[model samples]
Target: MNPFELLGVGRDADEREIRRAYTAKLRHTRPDDDPEGFQRLHEAYQRLLQIRRHQANQQPPVTMAAPVAPPAEPRPASTPTSVIRAEPVFVPQRLDIDAFCSEAFGRAATGDNRMLSEWLQEQPAFWSFRAKADIGQQLVRRLYRDEPAMPTKCLHVLLNFFDLDHVHAGHDALALQRLSRRSQLAWELMPEHRQALAARMNMQRRPLERCLARLQRPYTWWRALAAGFTPNSAKVMPQFIRELAGPFIEDLPPSVSQEQIRFWTSVGHKNPVSGSQLLFMAGVLSMLSLVVMLGAAATTVFSSQTDMPRLALLGIGVAWACGLLWVALRYYFVLDEWLSRDEDEPARWPRLRLATVPLLLVIGLIPCLLLPLSRGMGFTFLLPALWLSLRRYWRRHDHEGFYVSPGIARIGLLIAIVALPISPSWVFAVATLLAWGDDLRRHRKVLQLAG
Candidate 1:
């Protein structure tokens, strides 16, 4: 089947258009009337959205052409299926060792040096990841000997080494204090390599900064066109960027400080091809789905003498139901994010978001809804909207690299306005409008608490 038809929008529809259609459709479905069907619609919508969003950003496309079955490497019969052993291989050394050790550890006595050498040898990541270069190792050995005049960078390296590679030594917490210490001892402990790493990261920040500026809405009239028409696009990025970048965006620090956010954002934004690809594909599929639904709806309205429109609506709704079911099956992984709260913050949003789920489900199942529209049409419109509202409210604060800012109230208001006049359509549209509006209110309450 054409992916476009699957999403319920027109071909070549932009992200906003696709989003509008999706929200409108899912809002119509009553969740309790057919929970299983509602779930399928959600899944299809999620996957398609991810795909299109990546495409819009000029990222690489992800194809699920054949279920992407994992490579069937032959395994020993006795090996356990669940055992996991991951080892990082192929990481490059970034620090200069000769200067680090000579400057930092040269001041120490032989006995003190000997103790530090043993400690360095005990770090597991060094051995497992093979991150130890000869120069870095030599510097590490000297630091064990109490090297003098060690740079603060050298101290930072040791701190990272201890924090990331040494757990059993019980020095993890000490590393934090060591980093924060405002003394000569701390400065001497810093390694030259860490300084280099920081410098390199600083250098890498410019491109991400540029991309951020380019992607921000309202910076340029017809911004997408401006981005698309840029000349000499030989270096144009691919579309699969979000597959690589979404997690990093989620990981960015939530501080309001511009400098801090910039530093974190630099570390997160990578290749944009995946992101572009997701956006494009999602836009296309959703648009196509919208076209199909609209065409079917129009046909039903014009062909009032026959039950063809009803049957077509039923068909569209079934497809949507299947989509929601797909989402439900993968709900565990996605749903868990909604429950996660920042360790420093009181996690009010997560609590309220969870509390609203049952309410959504109940509101999702007003009997008046299904009586007017068949389950299939309901699935197409209602399920996607519900999931989008839930996801938006849950992850409202995450917006660094991936484009997660969806106007929930705007979408709700649009649905409500469009829903009022229609007869049979009112049931599906009204239900969706209510769910989205409720979600928006809940989101506002949490935002107030956060403020």
Candidate 2:
């Protein structure tokens, strides 16, 4: 082959083209990396260039006489030549779990229930779901030819329609939707047989459901409040109550039953407040409220009436009182009721009561704070009280699974940090507390080290 053609570049190709082609070919046939291949290409180029150069010089042509033919021995019988054609190279397809998951999610998003049901029915028996138990088993037998891990989530969703109190159905519907997206990706990660095994694993979902049910059945007051109507029976679902009460029996209050203990554990698992710490928080807040109120009344009655200093003092006093009241209601009232009572109604009131106090107090205090104070002591008290109330409220509501987002907290923090120092108006601080505090609290709960 011509050297230029071998390199796959034009004859009149510039040095750059030659270099580029050489680099491209070098990656595949590394004569330095592969000595024999490198030598062959190098030799071909040298021979072609040398011949071209010789032809360009154009010396007189020299001719040599043809050699006489040698006498041949008896000719061997001609052998047939066999021709073999090269097959095209195969390039294996790459599959990723995430990509497969995305594809599955896309299929689900089309909202074709028959197609969705058909696809799920094709899975291993244990992992399958049906509209009803009898039909589900028949489908499983038809699909898997044997029992397998059942898709508990699918069962829960279906069972909820039949009036079974499947607690997970309501909250986990969205979670299940997301998890199913990951199934496609998981499918891509395994071979056909392993995929079948995964289906089998899913088929055995009863144990997992039982375990989850055991963990999940207890009723927190928040959950009950969300469920609507007070709980008539202190009896938590049997499976859940047994597991949660065992570990903390000694730590539980005298009034608490095995059922109440189960419920309290459920509450603690769901919320930030728990153990003796919540009581401490309540005590602190109650004490702080009394101290702040005394200071506010003393200052307002005795101190000289000036706008800024008096206003700042009043702002601080009011904010402190709000925080104190919140801590008291949350710990001493709401949480206590939830801990003691069979249901959540009493506990929920305290949370609302506390949440309102700061907003109302802040509204009244803001105008006063904007006025000039005789001394900056008002701002000092106001700052801490504002910080504490904001922080408390923030922590109360915000959590990993809660509605608050991190971006919201960061924006509010930036605004508060910027405005609270320079702006005489309490708006910045209040906005920050309202917007970011809950988000911050939620984040802290997720990231916090256990005390």
Candidate 3:
């Protein structure tokens, strides 16, 4: 769009005239009602200003031959003899704040840091510490109101011009303290800003960053291993970054000095990547399963059966093991609607879905196929008793709305699946009685020791 036509102004109009045209359009085009129109007007306003600046720069300097000496009248010489003195007029320094924002934060670059610094110091409020606080507060409010306006340069300018990052306690002015207090706030900080802060401080990174890194580790680790290097490189980082960073940003628990947040927020975020531990663990386990398959294949060599059957079983074993790994991977990233709820009330699977039935069937089938009938039956029934002994190991974990691990969850699933093909009611009855018996025994032992 031609900005001149968009603003309904002639190309020769001054900055104030173009501003007036935009102001008129701004009133009629409410952002909520006509966002596109408002955006167009905003773009045109910025473009027109850039064009004006370019024109001013390119225009040749006007030079004229020296004016004739007759330009000075003889009366002026007579009047000068009276020793007329001209008083210095006080021209009030009015800060056109709207103009400042338009020039400073417009889409196009205004100038280098030096030019911006000069322009910023030109404001009257910059000289008065208290007024600097007042005017800066107004500019901040305006920026927040128009949040679509990114703070790439404006944030930097504000920190430098107002000294928002630090305060000198010995200073006589109290306004600097106010600016420092405002600087410590997190309401104006965005996610990218906080992540960058965490990176530079050598602090724990965001948990989401960790999750992503864990997910991507396989390709990276595989590449490294193929190149004859260590697949596992350890870094001592917090298990969860958000836990520590939350307090820092909010100034809760007084986690860090105010200067840290200020300097970090001032840095422009260009680095963009993070960690993912869960998927990396899954890949490690998958490789372990492959190693076990290799061991099983070696043991099959003694069998009298033809090599064809042994090879078929080996292939089936590999596929089945891989299926388990696939299930783990699937549950990790792509969960069903039931498991997608918030942590306060986590999602759960339905009763009949048969959670750990695959693991149970796989374990039970090995004994039944290889052992004598009597021993196999006894061992199959003994499964519930062995499971009941894990009472002390039933640890509680954070159900972070996604798969962190599958240990205890698979156990609970195994028990639920027992209700189907196994001893429908006796397994639960036996497990409950065994757990109660262990507790009773412990209680009696403790009492005996005390006595």
What TM-score against the true fold does each predicted structure earn? 0.20, 0.19, 0.31
Which candidate wins on TM-score? Answer: 3
The window of 10 residues in a row where model 2 has the poorest summed lDDT is 123-132
Task: Put down candidate 3 lDDT per residue, 75-165, tens digits, no spaces.
Answer: 6544545543222222335677888767765421332456666556545434334456666766656644543223234455655565554
* Residue lDDT tens for model 1, 1-451: 4445655777667655555555445445435565654455555555666778889788997574756658899999998889442222223346455654543354321214444544454433243223443444554445444434334444554545434335554444654343323223333113333243235344344443454344332322233223333322213222112321233333221211233233323323332223332233334345445667678778877776567666666766765666456445445444445444432455546556544544544444554366774545545445654565545544654543323236755665577677666644454445445554554464676556655
Clash totals, every prediction: 96, 26, 9
Q: Give candidate 3's TM-score.
A: 0.31
Off by over 4 Å in 3: 1-99, 102-116, 123-133, 142-157, 163-313, 322-385, 390-435, 440-451
Quote the lDDT for 294 in model 3: 66
Q: Rank the candidates by TM-score, best first.
A: 3, 1, 2
- Candidate 2, residues 1-451, lDDT tens digits: the string is 5667777877666544554565456447753367766655555444444444555678542222344658955655795555542232212233343443344334444434455444433322211112233443333233222112223333333333223324532436544433333332233222333334335445343443433333334535444333212121223333333442344344322223444444434544424445323333334444555556566667767877545455555766775577567555555444333332212234455434444434544554555566674325445444544554555444444443335466775776777787767764455356535544553354454335421
Residue 390, candidate 3: Cα error in Å is 4.9
